[model samples]
Target chain A: MNWTLLLEQTLNGFQFGILLFLLAAGLTLIFGIMDLINLAHGSLYMMGAYFAATLTKWTGSFLLGAILAIPACMAFGMIVEMIAIRTLYTRNHLDQVLATFGLILFFNEFVRLIWGPIGLDIPLPEVLNGSVELFLGIRYPAFRLVIIAVGILVAFLLYLLVSRTKLGMLIRAGASNRQMISALGVNINFLYTIVFGLGAALAGLAGLMAGPIMTVEIGMGEGILIITLVVIVIGGVGSIKGAFVAALLVGLIDTLGRSFLPDILGLFFSNDVADTAAPAISSMLIYLLMALILAIKPQGLFPPRGA
Target chain B: MKGTPRIIFIVILMLGLGVVPLLADYFDEPFYTVMFSRMLILSIGAVSLNLILGFGGMVSFGHAVYLGIGSYMVGIGTMHAVEDGIEWMANGFLQITLAIVFSALTGLVIGAISLRTRGVYFIMITLAFSQMLYFVAVGNERYGGDDGLSLYMRSDFNGLIDITYDNSLYYLNFVILLLSLYLSHRLINSRFGMVIRGAKSNEQRMRAIGFPVFRYQLVAFVIAGTICGIAGVLSANQTEFVNPSVMHWTRSGDLIIMTVLGGLGTLFGPVIGAVAFLFLEEFLSGITEYWQLYFGPMLVLVVIFARGGIDGMLVGLDKWWSRNSTVKNEEID
Candidate 1:
């Protein structure tokens, strides 16, 4: 009911949106560049969190744990690509889906075996654990702010990498036309492995950052996986810029809708009914947004050229 | 036309299924009935998937959503019949008819939007929509929310047929399954089936030949949904419970697996697949808690070595055996 509370919630939603971008960016890149539907990408995110949690426990430093987990995830990604993913490149989408889905099941059970079913807590470093005062008397978690800052910084770096770097050029070219890139004398197979590995690392970074705020559990990856799919679908698959915009939009709509929908509906319905209806409607907000976007633009907002 | 082999195979499979209770007298009747009913339900689901996936070449990851919708229809109808004294129609037959219609309508709307895209986008979109429906069902408190709803009694058959008894329910499911198989067989051999198959084989050629591929695919999708809807009705009666889990993406994956493992693009592949899959689950789960560790690798091996599936493998073996027998006879002569 309070305006400031509503404002704070919107900011919270934006922060969540930025986090989604970090995950979706990597997913869209791999999906776009390789034309592979990697359902196991979310597993990478889950692995990142678990790795960070265990490392943080060992090293007694959040920053050092995150730094170590990034490369570890990259290495893990390369191993997966070599052992399982390379064979999938020649198979049809259905096989890829089935194989990756099997990977998801395996990874979830693997995590359960290693970490047990109990949710693990990853505490923020003592220095950044408290709340920070922002605007007029509004305060938010300092860690969340840090997440937003990192998200934006990553986004900027991604732009520079995709738009300015040689790897980015190959990635863009590969996404636009894989056959042509291969014919142009590039080692398409190695490029695909590197892209897949980078994608995993990015997902790992998102998971590492998300550990403090969300419950780090075995199935945490599945829920966010669905949302990341929605982001890519709406933003247009294979476009980093599209993912960045769509992620923020989805994050805001989901957060703000959950916060304000009950109050908005209270004008017509009783409080009890409103409360029950609000959450369901709010959860559906992103899907409804997706449907509307598809209806208007079936190819998404910014499909990669020639895609 | 060579129809004898297929007809003989179907008869043998049916006889085998029918004699299950009689042949295994030691097995509990209720257990056989439950397993048979589940097979029937899942076969209906897999067959519907084949309509689109095999014939239409649309690999939908959200096909289970129809089953969910069908189940919800029964749940909601029963809830209204119990609470509001509102009859869905005049009788049990009409109520089931309404359920099929409702499920088909949902399929139509979802398909109309989803069939616009191809490949991975199509799969993801269908999955996203189903997940959307799942969350909605989970949030609805009146219907028991996450715990799901229980039916107070089996749906009334208006004195035409009694479903409350186990034997009666088993026979009902059996009759329905046979009818579905027959109908699916006929549909797959018809002119419409030819168009759908053509689309599956080569959409570009179908389009080049002036066929509107999307419309045909959409229609196939709706028919598939309606068939699965019937299965949903039977499932509710068998279990006397309905939940959002019916529409979960994993269930969709299971349906796809059933179709592929039995044999894609074949008339009875789904039925074979469903039976094999459920039996495997029952047998494997008995051995260890980590059954999936074994099961997952098996699936990968099947995809790798037996890409054509069990049915395909059987056919290959038969061909090789017949050739060997002919060679042996010539040497004896």
Candidate 2:
């Protein structure tokens, strides 16, 4: 067993987990507070990446492009909310799912229309392009490390906003009983939009970060969106803390399972059998984990209070 | 009087589908026969899905997984027959039976766990399970894996009917569609179906009234999956190939669209919805390369404005027709 390889994969898993958390946090927040299932959340992530890629090209600086893309994504999300999602709040989950499915189709085609069939590439700035040594003889990409750092910083800031602020109190109240909050003369509609925007911004950040790593393309959000949804479901639909924990768990399990399952299977079985089964089993690992979790604790690892 | 338009619409749709092959021959346009065959096969899937989604209110977003399963059964069966010299594996009846059994078992496992969760959780869980199956299919290298297996020949029904002929295949799909419709009609009105529908409207009330809602839902889920497997078999034959992409979540979304576009909780709506939805898709794609841009927003508008869909529109037309006839009769009297 190579310790360095294991260590490197673990760091990769952690980085991937952080990215999942960024997407899951906003998804959980919007779902928790608004009682809305926004399948188009992933589309916002795609938009963020597109915004960053295009803006970076214009500004000639990755930092400024990323900073500007957040607001652009927020504004796009708010517009979508006001026009399309607001009508869905009063409807059933099936309706929400179908309507948002439509939004996904629209967004994918919309991207294709504007950006053409090909994907856009976000170039890493010179400062973040190279690898840096972390410990003795171990080096990692500076950009990935930056993603981990930014994700942690954002998660910490989010924790403060949710736990230590008045708006956070209102958000908590809204999640528990939006009727009471509205009855208390709070502008619940405004709050809903703000939370939605905040969620969108978070998704945008995750997307922009993903751009340099993955191709900025149409339908890119969907593959990751499924993973994010799995993370949120495993964590507990409306719990931020749950999302964080579950994201890391899923990321590690998926990454590690793919890398190591074949070797482990080889010890017990023929090389041919192990090679054939590992990819299938490893790919199924997360979903199998999800099913097991749902079986044991259907409400997820951390059910929100009063949910 | 209210049912008049819907009845008329169903009759016309059935008649139209029944003659699709003959019409195709008359016009010398073989494409319509092929297109409608695909539509009818998928309508079977949509109708099966409507049983669980529309009546039972269990949104199994991974419904397409069964289609892939059914396809694989035929695809793998034929592959074994040809390569491994297992000739009996190519029998259509045996292949269909295996597809049903496998999909039913898959549905049972998926439903038992997913039905434990309600609402959006159910949706997400089902989606995840289907994805699991999709990945499994992709990883299976022996049966062409990700590229999928191409059938050298369609399923042999022991010379009962030759599906090699386009018309024969079309009629086969048509007969199956009617059988499924009949099955749905019987199942929906049956006592068991009442339990499923009742549970959908109000699960707690049904539970309080002594109905085991979860069991009823699970049964319906399995039944729907089995019927969809049949569709998959036909699909594999029609296209001569089966791939993992058939089980993709987007394909499931397409099924949901067909069901909803036709109308929910209606006997003939899904069939009608299949025709309308496919026609619109065919029509729109004919006009532009980016049909989804238009189609996506159109779907949103349908959900927003046309609550009941095309079937609902027919019902409204029926009401208006009856009202005008009644006024004329009153004046005559």
User: Judged by lDDT, which candidate is best?
Assistant: 2
- Range of the 10 consecutive residues with the lowest summed lDDT in candidate 2 chain B: B1-10
Question: DockQ numbers for every candidate?
Answer: 0.57, 0.86
Q: Kindly list the per-residue Cα lDDT of model 2 for residues A36-136, writing each as its tens digit.
A: 88888999999999999999999999999999999999999899889988888888888888899999999999999999989999999999999999899
Per-residue lDDT tens digits of candidate 1, residues A156-240? Answer: 9989998999999999899888899999999999998898888889899999888888988987888898899999999999888
> Judged by TM-score, which candidate is best?
2
* lDDT, residue B250, model 2: 93
* Per-residue alpha-carbon lDDT of candidate 2 for residues B1-333, written as tens digits (9 for 90 to 100): 345866887788889999999989999999999999999998999999999999998888999999999999999999999889898998989989999999999999999999999877899999999999999999999988899998888898999999988789899999999999999999999999999999988999999999888889999999999999999999999999989999999999999999999998888889888888889899999999899999998889998889988889988988888899899999999
lDDT of each: 0.84, 0.93
Model 1 per-residue lDDT tens digits across residues B1-333? 333444456568778877665544556555876786688789888988988887678888988888877677678778778778876522457657877898789889989999888777788788888888888889999887888888767777887898887667777777788888888888889988888999888889999999898888888888888888888888877888889898888889999889988888888888888999998888888996666666776776677678867778767766776678789999999
